[model samples]
Target: MPHRSELYEDIPSVCWPIVYSPDYNITFMGLEKLHPFDAGKWGKVINFLKEEKLIGDDLIVQAREATDEDLLVVHTRRYLNKLKAGKLAVDRGWAINVGGGFHHCSSDKGGGFCAYADITLAIKFLFERVPGVSKATIIDLDAHQGNGHERDFMDDQKVYIMDVYNRYIYPGDGFAKRAIKRKVELEWGTEDTEYLQKVHTHVEGALNELKPDIIVYNAGTDILDGDPLGGLAISPQGIVKRDEVVFKAARSRRIPILMVTSGGYQKRTARIIADSILNLHNLGLIDKELVASEAENSKVEKMIRDSVTDLTNLSL
Candidate 1:
């Protein structure tokens, strides 16, 4: 089996599979205005969830930063980085990593502001360490093509990729396009109606075509109507509905799924993410058995929380 990893910890049933860490947020000065991605949004999403009383800090799993050994599962030695939450997905029926989705990164190279291949790592970890998880399907809904995972799994038949992206946008890599089993290229300003319809059709078709052991849903909100980089135009409501479509499909098939919030440039993107998770709970797609006991007060957990709070003040 793969070398023992702390990533595959025995999670308490009282906690939801949703994974996050305070270090997930990247805040440095006031640069959130200049970049195409809101670096501080991850923490904001957690705060929104807290505001809604959907979950408490101890009720969600605390994600550990992937060590170099953990990253080597799917990354090149020269390009190693961090990721996890796959094993958690298998333990629970589903999981959502509030701070990943680097679709522009591959094992050998990183591009479009994405520095590591998190999605690729998540799948490979499962195939190597978890039984009955040999096959995986990647449903990438970012406005930009998920060239990173595509390149990493190019010749691997055990992996299936369904990408929906704007044809005119960045990283228009034709070579990477070949790896996508189901590709939906969109026009400029493609609104909710056309975007959602095509996504729904391709998602269902892809799932129908192959029943994989697990699903990796790369939910990138950069497709929101006015994103400077993403040329497509999809409304926030459309984005929520799109996530619902994917979750419903995975639930219906009883397949374990891991979701990564990949990209979204707008300031409101964090709220949208928390809203989608809440919507999923509202629809009965994801739920937790709230234990009557109060939250665990482990010393290690307190240390991690304090460390992350300090790191969030620094640049990522």
Candidate 2:
């Protein structure tokens, strides 16, 4: 049997695949404010969703902190220990981790305020533990390149990476650029039309190239206009539309996708994320009834399998 993990526990039928936890927010005596990134934005995103009646605490999947064993699935032991000396992981079926799009951190190092490679770990875990999940596609729309996972999965053919980022941003790792199969490098101050067009084109192109067992969408809100670091001019509506496009593509293909909210430094970024999620729900991309029906089907399948197993055992 595959190693059991709290992160992969079967969620209740009523719960949505959106994963989050209060601990995802970082607040060290207000020291987090020193950084340009809004450290508390994770909590704010959840709050806004709650206020909008899109999701409730009870209906959301609680994210468990990735343990050393879990992190080691994709990270080096030395790197895992480095995180242990410092600090410390997703679901299947169109799940979303409201926190943890740590795209700048890799197996051997950490950067860009990211301490662990959660995106890498999530994909590795799914491939290892989930049956028939042999391939993954990473759709990274973060304003900065997702150099971290790019480096980790450099030679791994099973993982296909598609990154869209401002070319001039921090950690401009030329070596990491080699890892991106579909690289869409945007110039500084790129606007909504051009950015969205590129995203739609490449996303469809990547899926058409190879339909993976799952998709790891690093849905960073930092692309919004006036983001201090993202260096792009995408509007809030653009962000919503972008998400809709990705979700529609994944749902239409019946591909299980997992999303992680990445780097968004602005105060309003949280609101934009919330609104985008609401738009997804409203559009039936993440329908509650659909999930409930899937859960019922799963239960029925399990019961039939159990009955067959019992009959076989009795005959033996």
Candidate of highest TM-score: 2
Residue 270 miss distance in model 2 (angstroms): 0.5
RMSD in angstroms, all models? 7.2, 7.0
For all candidates, the clash counts are 0, 1
Estimate the TM-score of every prediction.
0.87, 0.89
lDDT of 2 by residue, 226-279 (tens): 999989999999999999999988888767667778888899999998898899
User: Once model 2 is optimally superposed onto the true structure by TM-score, how far is the C-alpha of residue 95 displaced, in angstroms?
Assistant: 1.0
Q: Candidate 1 overall Cα lDDT vs. reference?
A: 0.76
Looking at model 2, residue 161 earns an lDDT score of 99
Candidate 1 global TM-score: 0.87
Model 1: weakest 10-residue lDDT segment is: 306-315
